[model samples]
Target: MPRFAANLSMMYTEHDFLDRFAAAAADGFQAVEYLFPYAYDATELRRRLDDHGLKQVLFNAPPGDWESGERGIAALPGREAEFRSGIDRALEYARALGCPRVHVMAGLVQPDAKPAEHRDTYLANLARAAEQAAAAGVDILVEPINGRDMPGYFLNRQADAHAVVQDVGASNLKVQLDLYHCQIVEGDLTATLRRDLPTGRVGHLQIAGVPDRHEPDRGELDVSHLFGVVDELGYDGWMGCEYRPRAGTSEGLGWLNDYQGENA
Candidate 1:
């Protein structure tokens, strides 16, 4: 069976950020992921992870001015400096936590900007981020978010994310394939994974129920079957549970229970 990581940012919202680590552990998760760790002291976060015996699997680099509505700055023109600074900050946390992968969000595209301009800025920023990440023995990931959830997100299509990874041409740069978003933008989950995983460009995987973004068990997508495909494809990376729980986080884990039984 594939290993799963709880997304503390989305799951375990019932508890404070620091408390979620223990909650996840108590609920049977061996690993965890979150949206951003910049708000908390890295040492404290690491201490909690150690206390809970949970590995930090993934998290995103800072999204610029989140309160002001900037999802990210990497793809926005003229914010290259800020983007690099965000990357450096992320590396600091990754180094402290021993997390291997960091996802860089591509900021929203402005109405006035051309697609080519945004793409160019994104590639340039990622190339630099990749170099920095490699030096720290870490990998950088770019995810294609569904525009419906994040309107104006620069990278929205699976093909587009793959193309950017190719254009960046860095060994440490890869795609963070979120199945929820992929299902919305591109329906052929099996085919897409089959094509992308073999190329070794996939860095990490995330899953949630489609249309509702809830726990994987109740959606249009057969998440368990998809896990089977991932196993068949020989993907050993962490798969993040990046979904909002319809009930409580632990209460909605029946899907994982079912999955574990099938695999066991």
Candidate 2:
């Protein structure tokens, strides 16, 4: 069976962030991921995970001022220093939590920004981040978010992410393929997985229902079938359940039970 990690940032929102760790454990999850972990002390978050017996599977590096809509600073010219500092901070937390991967957000592109300039900046920043991550034994992940959810996001296509990984020429740098975004940007999940998974460029995976970004059961995509594909492809990494529950987090978990039965 493919290991599924609850996205604590998007799941179990009824409880406080720190409290969600126990909630995920109670929901039968052995691992968890979130958007950012800098809000709380790494030691406190580590204690919560240990208490709940949950592994920290993944989280994104600091994305600058989220409140002001600065998704990331990596691709922004002249912000290389800030971007490297963010990588250091992320690795500090990753080391404390024993996490193995960190997603490097590419940030938004200004209307006047040249595509070539942005790509160069992004690749350079990633190259630097990859070196730092390698030293800490953590992998650097770059995800392609859908444009609808995040307009002007620099990285919006899977191929682009893969190209960035290739251009950086770092073994520790890999693409974080989110199925929800992939379905939105490009259909044919099965074929995409077949082509991309074997290349060894995909480092992490995420799933959500299409159109609504809800639990996998309610989406257009057949998540159970996709899970089977993932298993067939021998992907040993965690598949993150990065979706919003249409109801409560636990109430919408029937899909997981169903998947378990089918796989069994």
Kindly list the per-residue Cα lDDT of model 2 for residues 136-198, writing each as its tens digit.
Answer: 999999999988999999998888889989989999999999999999999899999999999
Top model by lDDT, which number? Answer: 2
Error of 2 at 258 (Å): 0.9
Structural similarity to truth (TM-score) of each candidate: 0.98, 0.98
lDDT of each: 0.92, 0.93
Model 2 segments beyond 4 Å from truth?
Answer: none
Model 1, 48-114: lDDT tens digits are 9999999998889999999999898888889988888899999999999999999999888867779
- Candidate 2 — worst ten consecutive residues by lDDT sum? 216-225
* Regions of candidate 1 where Cα sits further than 4 Å from its true position: none
Q: Model 1 compared with the native: what TM-score?
A: 0.98
- Candidate 2 shows a clash count of 0
**Residue 83 Cα positional deviation in candidate 1, in Å, after optimal superposition:** 1.2
